[model samples]
Target: MSRPAVLAARLRTAAWLGWQIEANWADPFTFIVYSAVRPLATALILAVMYRAVAGIASSGQAFLGFYVANAFHEYVIRVLVGMGWVIVEEREEFETLKFVYTSPIGMFTYLWGRSSVKFVQASLSLLLILTTGWLILGLRWDWGAVRWLPLLLSFVLGLIAIVYFGFFVAGWALVLPRAAISVNEGVAAALTLLCGVIFPIDLLPRAVQVVAMLLPFTWWYEALRRFLIGHGASARLSSFSDGALLAALAVSTALFSCVSVWGYGVLERRARQNGKLDQARLF
Candidate 1:
């Protein structure tokens, strides 16, 4: 097979391998049920909190929509982080990194394919959350009002950005075998706190807000809010036009992708030089 064909084949095989590894413990029906319950429970908590705090004077449901959307889209962060953390899991626990390297597949193809399963699971949770919100919790979105073009554009850009991040994570894990767990949690927490997940970026300290602006997640989330709710959660960025949001997402994700790919190459070289490819250091 040609190189592109080889990469495509490897990605498919890796994705299937990842799916069976993650879901084999539960039958398909049970796995779907279990995944559905966790996000719904979180959505319920956000709903109750909104009720106690705001009580229906929702300024046309902005915060209600914001928090609830945040609750349900938990998959975004989990998939992003899980993509990074998989390096540790497969390399250390399964003792399979060297085999994959020897199998002559590009690591990038392998990782992206493995992460696809998380994206699938997360998408399912998001669908359930959106349905429950519209039916039971009053999320205030109109299917008619959604800007499908911009929404899909931002969504695809966000996923591409996430794949870049996963590559960086796997690369760093190659070098910092001992700090894999800490690195995974630290990246996840940073996204959770600073990427405008729980609150708008404008509400963050001005200095921190600058860092947040550099992240693709910050732009991606705001773009999503605008596409879904007709306005964004950030007052500071409200003046930015739709064209500007798309431009910012494309530019920021591209820059970040460059940085991630560069960092990954550097780290992977370092790891190979130091003989850390199959090293495990959980302790």
Candidate 2:
């Protein structure tokens, strides 16, 4: 095959491998239950939190839309967690990392291809969560106020940054296989809280807020709230125009992806040198 054809074939095979591993792990009924329960539970948790703060009356309509934004944000967590988690699984659980490394296809390309299944799974979860938010949690649409430009830009760029962030986790996992178990989850939880998953970064401590401001997910979530709900959770984010938000997301995407690539190379080389790639220890 030609170069582009070979690349496409590698990506396709990796994606297919991922799908079999993910979806064929159990029977169809079990798979259905597994997929539906977590996202529904997540929606319920959001509703419970909303009710705890205040009753779901006229005033709660604002947070109902916030639920919409939160539903879409689910994919960010999925991508962030899935990328690195796969590395741990392949290395320790499946004993395939050394074999994968021996393949002609680049590791970065292989990992990205494997994560294509996550994008599909997250899309399904997004649809399910959005439905639950609308039907069970009082989410509603406001088409007139939606700003398509920043919304689209943030979604596209934010996803890029999220995947690269996962790549960042995967790089470290190659060397620290045990810590790999929790690395992506740790990263996801930290970003989810700090990046304003359901709360404003402005409410976090000043130093933490400053840290959040520098992350791409913060810009993405802020833009989602502003454009989708007509405003954000804080004045700092709400005051920025669509162009500003997109520019921040774009710039951060570029920077984060570069770091992800560079860091992955460094760590992968170290793993190769130290014979860490094939080590699988269960504790």
Candidate 3:
């Protein structure tokens, strides 16, 4: 398939998988209830923090905006990672590792569907969260519509990179269980801290700020901040620093995802051949 066609196929497959998952547990109220708790907690925390930093002007909105932005970005990443968790959990729980190894559909396709489903569900939750922020917290969607498009595209692309990173970690989960969750949570927290989710990274130690620049997340938030703040002193990062790094991260993630998928295929096949498939079974 051509590149566009391939991406389309993958997206289509993912959407279909998403529909399947939705159908399995089709309760809107349940979804809403489950999704609301975290954002509510976040709002309370925001109130406390803003109180502590009294008299700040746009920074309040900036902090709130960054929190919402991070919440939005994290929804996608969590979905990507959660899908892998499902598969690994199933393998350990059900003793069906052998079945997974022998399944005709490629493992990547299965994982793609799982991740895609989570992404869709989380997207819905994010829509609700953003809407709440706009209505209650007074977040103004004042940016020119056309100007925001690039940032939106960049955000989605950043998510693509995040999903690939999840797949990469999922590969690790197969061989190293204890280390996987620790690594996953550690990276997630570190990225959130580094990306200026709660506060601007510049206020931190200079060394930490430099490290944050290397992450895809910095690009993601910077794109959103630019859209919200417009062209100004707030937009400190250059096109080369933010835009270039995001593009590089996307490319790196795609390459790693492909490699991880290939590795998983090999491991599954070998496990099947060696009578160790049961050891890796989906629960």
Candidate 4:
């Protein structure tokens, strides 16, 4: 096959594998139900906690808006992490690591296709959360006021950044199966606390705020929030301008992509040298 044809075939295979995994695991209704319930339940719990801490009456619209917006962003992060975990699960539980490691299309391309499918799934989950929040929790956003062009651009850039982040995590999963679990969990937790998901980044300590600015999640969340809500509502902890934030996101995504590619190469080399690709456990 031609190089482009081979690449297309591999991507198609990756997407098909993703669909089969989803279908075999659960029916459409069940998948939809779980996705809707899990995020919504978590959001409601957080809403109650926020109200308890800040006082329901005192918290007001601004708090609710931020919370709801953050909840949606959090769902996106979780789904992205979940995409990495799917790769890990296939390696460990299904014992398919060897085949994937030796595939003609390469592990990196396979993961890209799989994560692309997860991105679509996660987008659906985000829509569901938004609709549920609007109906059940009285969450409101002025859809008409939003700059649609910029918002679409932001969504594309943000999702691409996040999908690349998933690819990075997938590389870790390839080599450090057990550690990858903790890594994914730690990342999710850290982003929640540091990325201005549920709270303004400015509220975090100066040292922590500095760290948060280095992460793509912080910028992605801020950009999405700014587009969805407004600049005033999505205030940053750092003194960076809007142009700076977008530029950081682009740079961060590109950096992570390079790192992920390098990491995959390292894992492949190590696996070949140590004969660990087919081994059930490293430790």
lDDT (Cα, tens digit) per residue for candidate 4, span 1-283: 8999999999988888887776456587877665567777767776777778866631355665566556657445555686567656776778887777676777767877776666666666777767766787776778877877666766777677666667667656666666777877876777788877777778899898888877766777777766676653445533567677678877876676577567667766765677656656533
Which residue segments of model 4 deviate by more than 4 Å?
25-30, 56-59, 74-79, 232-240, 271-273
Residue 56 miss distance in model 3 (angstroms) = 4.4
lDDT of 3 by residue, 129-183 (tens): 6666667666555645436666677667677666666665565555554455655
User: Would you list the C-alpha lDDT of every candidate in the order shown?
Assistant: 0.79, 0.79, 0.59, 0.68
Q: What is candidate 3's CA lDDT for residue 95?
A: 53
Q: Candidate 4: lDDT over CA atoms?
A: 0.68
| Candidates sorted by lDDT, best first | 1, 2, 4, 3
Q: Which ten residues in a row have the lowest lDDT in candidate 4?
A: 231-240
Q: What is the RMSD, in Å, between candidate 4 and the native fold over all Cα?
A: 2.9
For 1-283, candidate 2 gives per-residue lDDT tens digits of 7999999999999999988987877687777765677777877787787777556552265675457667776776666678787888888889988889898877878888888888888888888987777676557667797888777777888889878877888888888877887777778778778888777777899999888888888888777777767777766777777788878878978998899889988988988889898999853
Per-candidate TM equals 0.90, 0.93, 0.72, 0.86
Which residue pairs overlap in candidate 3's backbone? 90-282, 90-283, 91-281, 91-282, 91-283, 94-283, 96-281, 97-280, 97-281
Decide which is better by TM-score, 3 or 4. Answer: 4
Worst 10 residues of 3 by lDDT: 230-239
- State residue 249's C-alpha deviation in candidate 3, in Å: 5.9
Pitting candidate 1 against candidate 4, the one with the higher lDDT is 1
lDDT of 1 by residue, 1-283 (tens): 9888987888899899878876867587777565788778777666676567756433246665466447535656557677767888878888888888767677888888888888887888778877777777656666689899999999899888888987888788888888877887888778877877756788789999999989988888888888877778788777889999899999999999999999999999999999999787662
Count clashes in each candidate, considering only residues at least 3 apart in sequence or on different chains. Answer: 0, 0, 9, 0
